[model samples]
Target: MFNKHGTWPMKSSLLTRNVIILSMVSFFTDVASEMLYPVMPIYLSSIGFSVLLIGILEGVAEATAGLSKGYFGKLSDNQGKRLPFVQLGYALSAISKPLLVAYVFPLWVFFARTLERLGKGLRTGARDALLSDEATAATKGRVFGFHRAMDTLGAVVGPLLALLYLAFRPEDYKMLFLLAFLPGILAIGFTFLIREKKKERPGFISKTKFFDFFRYLKESPSNYRKLLVPLLIFTVFNSSDVFLLLKLKESGLGDTLVIGMYVFFNLVYALFAYPMGSFADKWGMKRIFVFGLLVFGGVYLGMAFAEQIWVFAVLFLFYGLFSAATEGVAKAWITNISHAKDTATAIGTYTAFQSIGTLMASSLAGLIWYSLGPEYMFIISGIAALLIGLYLYFSKL
Candidate 1:
């Protein structure tokens, strides 16, 4: 006999009720978000936004989300609640989707984009903590990995849908934004099915400063700090995926081909995320993460020289592998070393810093690309990532 809760026939320990529901929610949400992702640059360009402006917009939006992650993560811990934050966050994001096309002004576009990210900031910590609560340290890698796979699976479907729509509708970007809202609404509805165990309040009750999560570093285990430092450094070099898409477009690929490539990359990521997570559990997470960094370095360096369509295909394939290895594995490593009570706070704080680094990274990459060239930007980032990977590989953590 099988469990009645809709778990798979395989190990129930790794795929619990909450994990399944949350993954579904992420699946729907990504479908909504990614539907617009590949075409966003082209759309913005159509509307007169330059690469520099796009970079700044993304940096500011991400910084807003990052700053809030720390605060909201702390608030979730302080309140000993997760479901409310999750519900509200998804709802906000759902509403923000259609707002992208509600108006066409730059300010409105920026507002809509940042609002969606703000919703992401609000939910990330509490949601991941819920996932963390459902698994023990031994299963953390697989648990997080499975969630990522489900999430990226949405990335796969979203772009393909966009690809198909654009095939007939070509440059019909506004309608796509409206269509994306439907999946976001679906994501919000799924969140209603999620339930969370009541978390115990943290031992200390501190003042609610906006940047207070930064204080967590001093109080966290030494290993947490050790692990976070290199990760943050790497983030400073890793810009938004928009850059990659833009590069493909700049290389003279048609809109359909560019979107198709994104779909292909995400498909690879979805396929490999779960298996890589299991591998991370068996081999050390640190080792897997370092390997991912090496792959990432190679891909970026390769991207610099990639002009042919086939070369771009190979680079995207490796890019997907890099994502599969790193994203969930990094969170699992953080959660493993963190105290249970502070799980949301720990992940939130780290992600918050990562977002800040993203701002810097994207902005700098944009400036570099504008001043020098895409090749220089890629080479600098690739070399930096390789050096950081070497440092992490040799580190005691």
Candidate 2:
């Protein structure tokens, strides 16, 4: 679908080049982000921040993503350009890392962390919209899956790099944070490689104003709206990965083993994402997503019952499979069902919902854990997924 300077000897091959470039950008940026991410909670804990402060900080950091994701997404559609926002987002996030490394104080760290969320909000929707622009209907699943795979591979590499650096410089958190700047810059630089296709503005709509975030949702097809209900239900139960890591730590797992478990999870995610995406193309996104929900149900059920370390490991691996089936595959489906003009807006709305869902998931899970027990949190979450999966299947949506 993309014609970049007479390149591409084959149509299908063009998809590879574009997706791979995006993948590289995702890989490098994730490397930059994840390097600091794992370090944050530890750094805060070291500086004698309270768990309450840490919880509040984490909530603000993640929820800020919802604040801007939709706004930037709509702007991309209105302007008919994607690269500028993507580059700027990466730059802001990249710049924030060095700032965090230099100033480890509470106030400075707060701003830096919030800045990172802002960057994610700005870049994600626009970048996803661009990916959709390049892909044909037939290739959407594979393209999105490939992008997520590449993005997650960086997730795999980032923590390992952090772990290796920490192995040498155990107390040098600043150095680890500072080194993140390099990959962040590389990720921003890679944005130059993407070649975006232009679309003509519709005659009825005014060109002066763009990005009507809420109205776009009101006008979106029933499919998009229907899909959101189940997704929102699932997201409300799917809490932060931090909770999973924390569960392991509470169970007396070492820091190194905890990091290792995360790496293993990402590894499984990276391996399965592409294959799942291709399968979604052949079968359907809804069907595969239901299957993923079943996987989630199983993993959470495992978490509820398992008391052993090995059981947690097995559950973590299965959790990766659930992520592989959902993340990119959902975006690809949204791309197909949405209007061409509102594609970016649709993505923004979807992510906004996800951010809200994640916020609810974490807070509610904590409530459940405190009220009943940690095991009850996962048991309730598993049941929610099971009920929703049945709704989706019988509803035949």
Candidate 3:
């Protein structure tokens, strides 16, 4: 069992200071990120960028983050360090957020978003690996769930802050971007305080050959083909949240109201995350995960046909609940199948595959939305989700 200090121990508290600190870090960072999120698409549209460009931009950003996560995670593990990378990633994202606001050009916005995603890619695997290290086996579900809850809590508060700012200074997006810097800096500081426990390193491994890394993953029973197949299927239907946001816009909701609805979604996510995780722990991870998949499919289908803003908002809330049921719990499930030493690598691999899924889904959804219209995109996504869910159910994974 892992302890609060990220070492093996017989007994430990579910709510440790490190967990709280990490939660604070996530909270602040989400606040910074969320402030810019709602307006970004509108801002791009305002600047005369097409939906296709938006699709490409979002896809590339996510793919970059997803692909790099494993590499950075491995680097952190190899160096026996996490704080420096974590701090650097946060700093880069912090700098990028303000830059996007200051430089309103479309290409500049793309670069800024890409840089921010790069920071995310750099930090996520390492950070989650650290959380796994810090959590005891018995409370892993709750600990990860709590972290996600806190993270989404930040998401909840962030939009409200943005809403408040927009209320007074509606056009000053640049100011909101500038203000985002404060929380990121605080996150960096908190990262520095996190303690890294020592672990025995295996013999020297070459980093240049990427194929060898795949071979390593394949050879390890702890993280081989068994668990990966189901996850891959599930991810194929899991597109970017941008689609859902666009669906809201399609429902004829105003920008402020759309953001308010998003805030509501995060509120539901934050409220239910821990309790759902505990329930998953009791029932089974696979069971809850499959349920989330089904819920996601149903929500997408609802988005396709729903004409009312209120209906869309409720669907969004259920979408948040779906997230609460899965995100961290899925990671916890991965950790259950992986050994401590390769925790980051396994997470990185999982994230990398997830990125592939996002890239495919987002790019496809965008094309469908532009060519066939919004209705077909959700219809296809729902169909894909149903197929994946059926596969999971039958596979019994």
Candidate 4:
């Protein structure tokens, strides 16, 4: 059932305990996070914030989270502990949900978004490192894929819940925000229950700087550094999903239908995530990743030119395929090249640069959308992705 590494043990004979628990935690957390996430752009629009402002808000929030991922990643290495950072991060996010309901200003929403992302940044690196710690080289793809599938499954549930609540309450965004608190707390409690095994660590990290995400990269192999080029390029083309969802609403789908589309996207994501990961293991991650980038291009292009609402069901599924292929697979690829001691830092640095790309993309998309509309934004992003995906394939990254 496991690889030869004898690592990242399955708690039972069936699967790893850490994976199962972490998946559960992610499920509950996503359930909470996605419940409010899709609505965020809509909420901002309702509060008289311009599309440009929404783009800026998304960019800033993600950039902040990216910073946290990098910093806390190194901190986790120095402390040789992952659980505490995860716990603290979850606590910060868990408390911030209700505050959104209580305070309803753009500035308050911005603060709430940033505060919640701060928690995510802190938790993400340490948590991923912990996961990598549990994983073995033999099944890293499946392991990470399983985690993503569970996480996306929660995303599916969250949007569905939001859709149902909205169906009845009909724009009761406050109640939806308040109900999110339950799952967030539940996810946090599950974090405490995780039992991490002490593994051998390279003590050399403590002597290095705390915030240096790129420190390990200099020391990493040339192939590792080269692979980063295309990843960053593609990320720069990929802006906020908030804009994409907003695009759907702008296409004349009601707010409720837009949420339904999100739920549908997550469902496809949950379904494909594990299988795609396993496929990557057998077929090869680079091929899958390259294919995913192309799929991203197709999805974006389809959304850009979509003439009917029926097209959404298909394009959104393509979006799910792209997400399943890239996210866990990319992490698995990085983990494969990285030294055991510095997984968190490598992942964090990767995340940080990608977020930088996201910040730029969102900012640019906002400006483009403001002038030309969503169609042009998607067209530009799609063309860029297509070019980048071709480059990555040729580069063999």
Candidate 5:
């Protein structure tokens, strides 16, 4: 029932001006981020970072982003504004790219990475709230799904750009990091095109305590909690995708092929995100999400046994489907169940805990990878996903 300018003009078209512009912003930002993503692990390895250290770096960075998401999300709600947060967040992220190579010290690398993720934290709730405000319960899937598709399209272009560059100059990661800044700036520019509807502050302004966002869980409807519980549980088993790339590398694939697989996975993701969202709307968000989990279970289980390059390709293909099915669909599902006023807070709190879960997941996965081979890690994750999928399928929620 939220509409930006009064009545919803989106009955005929879901891709309103704000959604397109925001999606463009996401598209460019992702381009910047993903350009570095496929190379990060390899670059760290070249600079003497062990797998364990990499895990810790990702964990710490994500934790920073996660915690800030809650605070900033709550702040946005209190202030009844989204544009400033979105603008500032993208600006921080835009500048953080070139800083990645400003110095090669491990602490500096951690600092730069955390700064970038912090930007993500700053904007996630506000940005998503804007998207939610543009759509109704009926169209949340298409709106979010379209945004994700556009965002992930950048994921495709980014690595492909990196791959092309690396093809010419194989180890020039620093220069590549510097180049990523261009797309980031473009993303920032797109942010200016976005205009939010003015909203009055609630009668009860929430305090801006760092952990205050967590209180929403108690206040939220049962359905919100029910949906979140299984998703968060699933997140614990789902480590960073970096681990997947590293696994391919450990299996003896070269950098180019590893990155290529990543690109292909994203390509599949970009292609299917919108369609999957439409499917969620037509069928049920919960049903599509459960199906995505089943696909994820299959992909990981397949990764457990696969040794051939072709096998890995097939798995990555399915992995993309898993991403398509779940990512935006989950957000749409949450927005549907949450109170409209608390849109940003609901997502921020969920994502903050999700970030914490990611920290745990990445750290745990790293420990498992260090102790027992990747096979065991993949198997454990696969089994856990399958179990969770079944549980969700049977649950009444």
Candidate 6:
């Protein structure tokens, strides 16, 4: 029997509780974070930071999270616990949200953004590990996809909430910051309901060498290499979302419309995420991932040439579709390639590469935007996407 909350009857599998709790956690935290995300670039610009500094700050914030994900994921595996790390990450993010309201200085904003990203890094690998542990192999894609749907559901609501807050309180950005804490606190409260599982340690102690993880990955006879190379190539063109917002601003959209476009993207993401995952399960993850990459390339191309408000909005929606198809499914693919015992480590490694990709993409896009124009940034990204497609077509996964 299912509960009113739509949760299925609790069973021995990790799918039910872990997905439920993590989804709730993500939904609430996103409500808090998205409240500020759409407006952040404008806020920074208002406070006298140039586009270059904003790019640096955004890149640094994301890279910081990427850098920590593997380390914290490994730590969680070593310690054999997921809930504690998840809890800690959520709390830190919650605390950081309110800090934005209290401080107006640029450095403070940086610290707060970094803190939030750190929280994300700390929780990501462990969270994926937990989801994998709980799910049966056959249903792993569905489980993760559901979690992504839930997470995107939060993303969808967050912008709407931010829009409402801004509607009534146009002059007070701090209030939105303060209001973000509500969803975060709720997410934290629900986390205590999740049960932790015990991990079995191998008889021989694994060496803690810096490259030890990659060595294991190399030794494994899995299709990981097949997926990793293509995915990494696709990531090279996938710059930060800040560029999208900046593009919208450049096109003369108001802050309200820009945030509304973000809401539209998240709405599409939330709607299609689960179906996309289910589709992948029925077909194959590799095909879906590649298709999404191609779509993403097209979206970027559209953004490069778009001038009308409606055209830009349509591109954002397609961008959402691309994200929904790939993000959670990539994690599911990683789980397919790695052993259960090394789930966190494998996820950490993949996430690290993804972060490195973001760092490179964002930094390069920023330089392009500053030096040439926004159009060049998209053109370069488009070429990278096309190259990734060609590479993946020939590569075995």
lDDT of 6 by residue, 189-308 (tens): 988877777666555455455444465457555687667777876776788887998899998999778877878888898888887877777787777777787888888888889999
Clashing pairs in 2: none
Candidate 6 pairs with clashing backbones: 14-134
Q: At residue 45, what lDDT does model 3 achieve?
A: 81
Worst 10 residues of 2 by lDDT: 202-211
lDDT (Cα atoms) of all candidates against the true structure: 0.90, 0.84, 0.78, 0.82, 0.90, 0.79
| Candidate 3, position 216, lDDT | 43
Task: Please state the error at residue 137 of candidate 3 in Å.
Answer: 3.2
- Give stretches of model 2 more than 4 Å off: 1-14, 201-211
Worst 10 residues of 4 by lDDT: 5-14
> 163-267, model 1: which lDDT tens digit per residue?
889889999999998999899888888898877886566666766788889889899999999999999999999987878988999999997788789889999
Model 5 lDDT at residue 86: 98
lDDT value, residue 49 of candidate 6: 81
Q: After superposition, how far is residue 16 of candidate 6 from its true place, in Å?
A: 1.2
Number of the candidate with higher TM-score, 1 or 6: 1
Candidate 3 or 2, higher TM-score: 2
TM-score of 4: 0.89
Candidate 2 lDDT:
0.84
lDDT of 3 by residue, 1-397 (tens): 2454543255346666667677778989998888777767776787777988987888778878887876777677666666677777887888887787677687898899899999987888778887887776666777788889999998988878888888898777677888988888888788877776666666786663332335446655643466677677767667778778778777778877777787888999998888777877788777787788888889989988998977887898889889998898888888877777777777877887788877777667778999999889888888777777677667745
lDDT of 4 at 303: 81
Q: Which residues of candidate 3, in runs, are more than 4 Å off?
A: 1-12, 44-56, 101-111, 208-213, 222-224
Tens digits of lDDT, candidate 4, 1-397: 3345432454422246667778888889889998887677677687788977876777678878988788888777776788888888888888889886676687987898888889988888888887887667767878889999999999888888887788789878777888999999999999987877786654554454645666767877677798888899888789878787888888899877887888888899899998888888778878888889999999988888895788988899899999999999999888888777777777888897888888888778888989998889899989888888888788855
lDDT of 5 by residue, 162-203 (tens): 888998999999899999999999999989988798887678
